[model samples]
Target chain A: MDRRTPVDDRTGRRIVPETARRADRPPTRYGSRPTMKDVAARAGVGLKTVSRVVNGEPGVTPDTERRVQEAIEALGFRRNDSARVLRKGRTASIGLILEDLADPFYGPLSRAVEEVARAHGALLINGSSAEDPEREQELALALCARRVDGLVVIPAGDDHRYLEPEIKAGVATVFVDRPAGHIDADVVLSDNFGGARDGVAHLIAHGHRRIGFIGDMPRIHTAAERLRGYRAAMEDAGIPVEDSWMSLGATDPERVRRAAEAMLSGPAPVTAVFSANNRVTVTVIRVLAEQPRRIALVGFDDIELADLLQPGVTVVAQDAAALGRTAAERLFRRLDGALVAPERIELPTRLITRGSGELPPAG
Target chain B: MDRRTPVDDRTGRRIVPETARRADRPPTRYGSRPTMKDVAARAGVGLKTVSRVVNGEPGVTPDTERRVQEAIEALGFRRNDSARVLRKGRTASIGLILEDLADPFYGPLSRAVEEVARAHGALLINGSSAEDPEREQELALALCARRVDGLVVIPAGDDHRYLEPEIKAGVATVFVDRPAGHIDADVVLSDNFGGARDGVAHLIAHGHRRIGFIGDMPRIHTAAERLRGYRAAMEDAGIPVEDSWMSLGATDPERVRRAAEAMLSGPAPVTAVFSANNRVTVTVIRVLAEQPRRIALVGFDDIELADLLQPGVTVVAQDAAALGRTAAERLFRRLDGALVAPERIELPTRLITRGSGELPPAG
Candidate 1:
């Protein structure tokens, strides 16, 4: 089945389920306004003339323009921008799909995208997928229906073949933070594997023999890559991997607290912990605070005020805004007539050490 | 001049300034894709029937819909939701205007707005005003031209009378974080005055006779309210506030640092400080850390990892998400046919004492 089928197809419109449910509702009381056609008729001008005057396109003479303008003001016509945007092609808008807009990591990322879109004179429409595949698909298709000029997606789904149809239908697509699944597309990413590896190595280099890893669900690409990085660092140190040292699941504070506590429970507790993301790192800091002993830490993703904590949080800092900037710039590049095969672009991460990563293995 | 003018008045069309600049440029290779009319022609159906099938609107026989769907697929016709939404009235989209999306405070707040919009089956188009009135007005008007169902604005400009035309034209608008100047409208705000008063009083109760106040530009409503609160607290405690005890300007770190250092450099420095915002508070924290004496601080807005710091930061916290959620819910309530007069809403603030707010007057 075509992915761009009727909006409410089999699954119903995830976008407007209520509208689909109450399809017969009358237009809102305030919605009975005039359209461009009304302005055209009122001004005794052609439809195209009304469109031109409303869009500010330069073609009409001064006197004719004034008459159209007068009619527009008299009738309260709004140019039907959606219709104008349709007839003209190119919406001058882009859509950004992400896991959560509220997450600190994505906030800068979203801002970066907006900055780039502004530079290109385009507006941005975004929605959170909440890390669900179905939601991702639903939101993505909704934007497609809106006919955005392009799309920047932070993937949640394992398979994105559903997007193939939209991509073919003239929508520019770029994936960031994580690569698209089961599809070849332009992707901008932080070197998750390398970043995690470096964070783990920093702990091991501090003379911590036993170390723990806390991360998100293994199904997530970044989490899985971080786990691999941890193993690689341990293997390089000739330390045997311990299943008990790894806990991967949700990044909620409670879950992370439990994971960190469990890892510190055994007689062979880890002397240090490598947190795979900012949320996990934050929770781990609280968990360690309650413990009597100091647990060394090296976390992925630097956070605000990380440098002011007791030991200061040592982190592998990935530039989220840079990722977004790079992806959006590349998208505009594609829109500007650069035809090339889709490729993956990975930006490097920096290790910022104030003190936490430098701590020796605790007694 | 008409607000929607800039397009060719009688000439017939516009909206692509860059395109108009290079009016001679070729169509994008992907720009020749078939439109809804093309699909209609192939499906041998009326334009309305094609729209009905595309939007999943009722009254379409299955046979006609199937033929339309086939034509859409065969011709790769992606529905122009912008146009369809115009004909139907109600675009199922809202606009959000704010200071900066990258700011941690707004990240969650914006998310709350998006969540509410999603539940109502609408998309959110947002732009950062960068604290510029002109930029805010520009962004707001652009979204109006796009014909969003409603707008949630955190005003960067004091006067919002410019939006009167749009609001009168049927856009449901709600002011957030800051009230609209010169316009009567629905406003949802944190108890800026009471919160600041209580926070300053907390410092005075700890025997701090001379307390400094650091805040954003005084022209901002919240900042002015906070200063008022600070003065009220001082008057209530019978302590006189000195000129050196107040600094109001940009919240940039360097300026804030200079202000803090300048205040502390006096012969008789403030024994405590009431930071009026998170940005100001974070900067003051660094400055105080460098000084030899202990400086009690009570801040508005909580930061990430506040509790993890050596002396946990004390704060009078206003729920940013609640501010957003309340504004959004109220916006939807207006859209849902509630005919109520515009009113002001104030959500309460809570003071949380950690270690920083309890410091004694020190030399």
Candidate 2:
């Protein structure tokens, strides 16, 4: 028997734990909600007859159908969709695993996926991985266990061998914002490298060779890609990037603050800054605002009220909604039995020149 | 009969639709996954014997267990959790319905609910109602049909009597950001009225007799309460309010822009503006920035990088995460069998004075 939980430790109440709730009490299904078995008993008919009537299948006489319907109303017997789903073989639900729901960047992406799922007549269930690999796997598998028909993942880990079994078992999955490691799967991504390179190059074009780069941890695929872009932009300009100008680590306010401060204080400080992502850019904006001289800055992602700021923030904008919509559309296509090999779809990014990016280096 | 879908219209290929996938193949449980009967046949045992081993019940011999395990591995059969959930009274999942997922204000709130749900080992599935009553009802009922253990609702509709049957059937629910209509359900809210009154009063203290109130539609509870607070503040100061000074409707940029423009233009224009929410605040900031004379502004909800602006935004800040965490905790407590009456919990909002709200009236 499953580990029987007779009471909740926190409340010390006799509560039926999730695992044992229905297993312990087999008489009534779903806590006093009458089952088809109950409907059959009340209707004085066989279980099959009740099932047929409930499912609206033929061969149930009018009198039998009336009896079943009456029993259903009397007993408040709403057909358990769990049983219906079990019989149907599909849950009509899809799972979305994202980095963090609280991140404004992901909010649009998640919503886009949900809209697509809704259009396809599938409910979307999502979880935030908090950018942890183990948590990502746990959440993904749990969603799979619930038997969601498909998955849209923003992978935290490089290795996804754990999903192999589930994939083989016919769970269609698509990765977004990042690609899956050690797995051949459909991936939807923004042109992170190109976008970042263009953003950095734009700053360089504005007469700044010593431009600082503040980015997320290099382990993250987007971070690594963006960092590469920053280097390539400098290399193309014949400006050898100095070690002090590159800060690649955590995007927390404290760390980014220290990084910005350290870079600005050196004997030869960077005159401009390339913020790799939104979180990093917000902190950098705060740091730059207190400075005696304005520092030219460019951010990778667009933020709300960016245009309304004193010097509007310039950004290499990627469409988060487009990324999500593409991935979900592809997932549905796969589910529609389109026999196509896994492929990567990269969406283009645009650079919007707001006042900040156009500012010349302050002496 | 459940609609027999022989082919997918989009792909023009044979497909197993959500409803009939398992009903068409009773021998198989989930899309070619082996059933207990398959295992029993391979292990030379009865169906009940196979089930006993699978469910970890007593009286299964070690030899039989080994044989069943081998058959399971041979067929690559994983137990269908949909069926497991059917046998288990609880699905171990909760549903969250919010106004919009892409809104910055809701991101932290949703994350908070997810965190609490995680603590209780329940996965949260949420949908954006887009503030539409019909959509809210559809999503809530669908979640109910899926048998989610509880629901955390940020109600979009005034009438939630539709949830009566589901709530009575033992689906624990808690309303957040708003209250349930016609039903006395547990609700967690920010002190909208008191916060708004204090915000408007702050402008009054700063020597602005002509204050303007821009808010959401009065039909919304928070919006109406905030408007009431604005009126009370003006009345306390013995200043007769003009009809033209108030704009209460949609918070979209276009509408908010028009509203802000209208309020600032007329004879005896208001010297200060009180923005009701985050979205409204953002739009108003833009309008105020473009003005030749600085307009004192107080907004509700602290926004990102608010302090970095030329005149940092002063806001009546509500803790969104606290609201969500509190509501989720109550939901889990109800699930834990807390036999308490549905109560309203009000969290206090804070007044953060940066620079904008402190500005004196322009000459």
Candidate number of the best TM-score: 1
**lDDT per model vs. reference:** 0.86, 0.87
Candidate 1's TM-score reads 0.88
Deviation in Å, model 2, residue A201 alpha carbon: 1.4
Clashing residue pairs found in predicted model 2: A22-B89, A88-B22
Supply the global lDDT for candidate 1: 0.86
RMSD (Cα, Å) for all candidates, in order, is 11.4, 9.2
| Candidate topping lDDT | 2
**Candidate 1 per-residue C-alpha lDDT over B191-238 given as tens digits, one digit per residue, 9 for 90 to 100:** 788889999888888888989999999999999999999999899888
Model 2: residues >4 Å from true position, as ranges?
A1-30, A36-77, B1-31, B34-77
lDDT of 1 by residue, A1-363 (tens): 113323334422211111121344334455466777888898899988987887789999999999999998876565557876767778999999999988999989999999999999999999999999999999999999898989999999989988876776678999998988876678887878878888888888889989999999999999999899899889989999899999999999899999999999878899999999999988999998888888899999998898888888899999999899989998999888694567676777889998989999878
Compute the TM-score of each model's chain A versus the native chain A and list the values. 0.87, 0.86
Backbone N/Cα/C clashes per model: 12, 2
Error of 2 at B284 (Å): 0.9
